[model samples]
Target: MLTYVRWYWPNDDLWNYEELDADRWALRHVELRGSDGVFLAAASLAEVLTARDSGTVGAVAEYERRYGVVPEAPLPPPTDALEPALESVSPGEFERLWRDARRQLEQQTGI
Candidate 1:
């Protein structure tokens, strides 16, 4: 599968500076490729208007009830010796790490 660039943004109605602190806001976006990458899909959200028209009222109900309460992203990984160990790094540096790690893995497997 191709990698994607997903990001977060505010949804306004549910979130604002008053509701959330200075560091926070409402919705987050997880963009995915569709229709030759022109059209985008968010992994966390379904198409509300389309779902309503499709007679998926149950889906809409579920969405309304569970949208903000549950996070679509994976829970934070537990710290352990075997894990990759994440940290904050710039994109350029991160890419370099990915390249180096790929080389190491390939070397180990003789790929």
Candidate 2:
């Protein structure tokens, strides 16, 4: 199962770190999302920790220093009534849906 870790700092800053596995910790496919829930960056664990990028490195360091570890339990599900439970989907269906959503988003934002 996918694992998610989150950190909320001062000034309403927040970040979501996602990894495919935690047991054999690695960041090969890790994803980082910004406070606004926008995709920020994807990098290996080593690179993120050792890179000179202050913002990203600082965030990670603060999270680890305060939290004591990485890849903690997944955040609780949204409490909104409209939120749906997790569901499984076939790869083909997922790809189609993802593509459609991307197309719609690009059309709306002209990105």
- The TM-score leader among the candidates is 2
> TM-score per candidate, in order?
0.26, 0.29
Which candidate's lDDT is highest?
2
TM-score of 1: 0.26
Q: Would you list the C-alpha lDDT of every candidate in the order shown?
A: 0.32, 0.40
Which portions of model 2 miss their true places by more than 4 Å? 1-84
**Model 1, which residues run further than 4 Å from truth?**
1-73, 76-87
How much does candidate 2 score in TM-score?
A: 0.29
Q: Write the per-residue lDDT of candidate 2 for residues 32-100, one digit (tens) a residue.
A: 234444433334455445543555647766433322243333334557464334233344543443344
Candidate 1, 1-111: lDDT as tens digits? 212122322232121011111232212222222323221222123344444567765866554333223233342333545433332334454344334433543454466
